[model samples]
Target: MNTLPIRPEIPWLAPLAGYSDLPFRMLCRAHGAGVTNTEMVSAKGLCYFNRGTSSLLNTHPEDAPLVVQLFGADPDSYHQAMDKTLEMGFRFFDLNAGCPVRKVTKSGSGSRLLENPDRLYAIAEIMVNKAGPGAVGVKTRLGWEKGVDTFLDVAKRLEDIGVAWLTLHPRYGKQLFSGQADWSRLAEVKQAVSIPIVGSGDLYTAEAGVRCLRETGIDAVMFARGAMFDPAIFERFHALMRGEESPPRDGEHLARIVRMHIQYTREFDGSDRSFRKLRSFIPRYAKGLRDIRSLRNELISCETWEALESAASRIREMQPADPLGFDPADVIPD
Candidate 1:
């Protein structure tokens, strides 16, 4: 029998596109994210040798136990992509069957796979065979559309094929990120599968994460937008789970996170593109600050790394207010 590489009790970072880069993963890991995933990579792109895909795979030795998530509609593409990642020394992998973005859905990948359970199972079977038992997992949604309870069947089939774990965000693909994630469906999936079941969706706070773990009896929690708003969510989740008194979010702590993100981004990829990306990200990281609008404006206006660094440093000197952080804006495009 194969076991998951990660401990079920600690929080894992979700495979966020555009946001969960190498630097961001390191930031979360530094703050206590037990396992971090690469941004969803294109299996087809890997086989085609797409230059952009290479950047998504960048990692440091410290970013260990990373899961390289791959999305594609073809088993052949998955076969080749897994080969490349295994050769690259990635020990863990995930099938991205949960993304509901229009681009991914239109390609017959992502949550679109939920519509064709046979095809999804075929692809998952190939991944497990190629990667070996306990090396592969699948992330998915409740179903392709509302009124469809497609998750339970899909979860059972994937488990039968020996995929190591399942990360479920309980909402229809068509629903995207709208409305509430029906966590009741999580209990149903958990009862259906014998393997580890990791719960996702609406886990935007440490309290919610702890509540979900207790209420649903799932194996672990994977933080998405919650971790985005505050990378320390992983640490906070653990603290709350253990009944330990966690520290409140403060300027000094937030400042450290910003500084570390900047240093890691510079160390990994400091080109103008990376700099501009960091400029956009700092405001999100600062959502818990007392004056988000003013801070947001300042960050958006920054033209140089020096100016941005100056603004971020000022955060350390100010006292903070939001208990955890601003609820991450729902407007995030995933």
Candidate 2:
């Protein structure tokens, strides 16, 4: 019999596209995240030796317990990618079935696999068998549509096939983050499967994360958008669990991390590319500040690191809307 791996019960950073790259993962790790998964990588791309996709496998010495997530429907591609990933020194891997992006779903990958449990199971079995028992896991949504209990069967099937663990986002594919995530289904799915079940979806506050684990009895909690808003959330979660009050989300602290993020990104990917990439996240870092949208638009239009630094200097001089208590609800559009 294959032994089950010990599931990480602490708060983790969920794999987020364009956001959970190496520098961001390092920042979350420095805060308190026990594990950080890579953005969903394409197994087909790995099989075909795509250079851009292969670049996503980059890792740092500090990024231990990293989970590389792969998304694809081909078993052959999975096997090939597993070999390559192992060769690249990755010990933990996850199959992603929770992504709701149209390109991925239309390609018969991602959440589309939820429509056929057998194929999902087959692909997972192949991955686990090649990666060895307890080395491979899965992340998936509840089902293709709302009011469907398809995840119960999917979770059970994955458990029986010896998947290492399950990270469940309690939202249907059709919903695509439209409505509230039905966390009630998480409780039911956890009870249906023997494997560890980690809960995701709408976990913005430390209290919300604590509730998900306490109320639903999940093995752990994974933060997605929450981490984007504040990488220090991992630290906040730990403090809350220790019976301490939540930490302050002041402008000084936010500005410091934003600068640190910029520095780290520049070091990792160089100045120009990092500045371009940081555009998407500038608005997020500028939350709760006065005239942030306009500032964000200006920063997004900046062509060089010098211009970004100048813009950031202006932001530091201004006072935040609520200096001590930054609201998590004030999200800027992508």
Candidate 3:
């Protein structure tokens, strides 16, 4: 069987909704993310050529080896979407069977796919057959609810279908981001599957990323909320992996990266849509600033990029403060 075409020991950036844009992906890549997946695309949207869906397919030369994640239950829709993605030069694909949103699950997709194992297996089989071996993988959760070991069976099915790799986030569908992620579940799945397993869920710090790899013995680790708050995480984690001292993340570094992210967004889409798209990110970049609450309100309401830049400039000049009540154990939303 073909294996995942990514490096081991390098942390991955998870495909987050409304956050894993090209600009953010580029930053993480530069910061040492071994691989990055695009935000999940609707298979039906791509089959119909929806304008919004088309925008998600955008890529740059620097973002090579990108994994395009698709969500839907229909085999035909997946086939069509895969065709379009391959034509656009995306070589890696991930089927999202873990999304817990009601709107998605209500349609017999996302985590709901877990309720119907045969159908889920069929989807993986179809994706592998259609996209070709080694080009497709899957990202899924433990099961539809707590206390169910459905994932163990599903993982084996996916391996039987020839999936390149399996990225398991050890949370039940109903669990959402509530409660703790069962790392033991990850270890269980790892033992069950022969293919490479990428462990995810609740990994929000460079230290956690390191520990997960060592404890779970999975092939790789993926960061979602952690990367959003600190794109430099991969770089720092990479340094630690190599037994080297991590570079500093002082005020100047944060300011420079914030500026760069804004510039990249502007270049990607020169419109208010992109401007609004960046509003939520400001707080992430300004996470540890003095009085971040006030700074967040100011940035979230900016109407123009210039205004946004002005807000960012003020944040850069402000004195950096230690994180407010920061807990290394807290898992931020993805």
Candidate 4:
């Protein structure tokens, strides 16, 4: 029998609202992302048939093995929305129990669910039943507040309730993005659960990706802001895993991805909104490029695709200041 590779099993692209749109997803896939997730959508919004929510669920032929993430406090609405998701041909569904935004938690969603494991189990059970076997999963943080650890119990419950997988960010809600992620805790959860455990947070480099997988013994790894800064990270990590030297970052290729992303966003969500969304990724794409601050400022101010394309072309002409150490400062916190 041929044994499959276990460590660094899958290169995952995490869902960032407005950032992980189809264009960026396709770019990541082209480069080497193994699995990609959609941005978190409101279960209530989907149940209510909101146009914006519906558009977020849209996927192209190339966007296969996609996971659609849903956020809501009510189990009934979650069930209804997941039913609709399945009707729309999505096989994988993830429940968002980890978002720490004030607006989300205030509504009893996101990280707030960690406060009540029973409720979390109830919701996961309903989604699992609705999604049938091997269709449901959960993504969550370590706990709700500082110094509180609930991931071990949460992971076990999710496994017992038939969750196919679990993605742990390994940070408490109170910590937000500050401080380092507790990788040891992730290791603990990995040992506690039978389901596939995906360890997330602070995996910004290929070295860190390898370190996290080796240290935590996770089934796979998930990339959020790190992927935004370097879309080639997955490919680079894959090369490193195979005992090959990491490839050099190509500024021209990065610029081309930016252009393609802008076009795809425009095609997917017409009007200036798509352009506006594309602006969020500029800082990442332009990281380490000379005078990118000025270039990004100019690009963000452009109101049309033509203008955006012009600015991008100008950015492409300039060489990156530091080829290897250019980390984008505008990473979205998990």
Predictions in order: lDDT: 0.86, 0.80, 0.81, 0.80
Across 1-334, the per-residue lDDT of candidate 1 in tens digits comes to 1345555577899999999999999999988888889999999999976779988999988997789999999878888888898899888889999999999999899999999888889889888888897889999999999988789888888888999899999999999888898888889999999988888988888889989988898888899898888888888887887899765788888889899998998899888999999988877777756876787788888888788898888778666665555765542634
Best by lDDT: 1
Ranking by TM-score: 1, 3, 4, 2
Expressed as tens digits, the lDDT of each residue in 257-289 for candidate 3 is 788888888877667777777777777766666
Q: List the residue pairs that clash in candidate 3.
A: none
- TM-score versus the correct structure, for each prediction: 0.95, 0.92, 0.93, 0.92
Local lDDT at 29 for model 2: 83
Off by over 4 Å in 2: 1-9, 322-334
For model 4 the local lDDT of residue 39 reads 89
Clashes of each: 0, 0, 0, 0
> Model 4 — TM-score against the truth?
0.92
Model 3 C-alpha lDDT versus the unseen true structure = 0.81
Compared with the true structure, the alpha-carbon lDDT of candidate 1 equals: 0.86
lDDT tens digits, residue span 1-334, model 2: 2333334347888888777888888888888898888988999899877877977887888887889999987777888888889888888889988888787888778888898778899899988888887788888998887777588888888888889789889888877877687788889988888888888998877778988888898888899888888888888998988889887776577777777777778877764565788877766766777778778878877887778777776666556776433454554211
Cα lDDT of model 4 overall?
Answer: 0.80
Selected candidate, larger TM-score, 1 vs 3 = 1
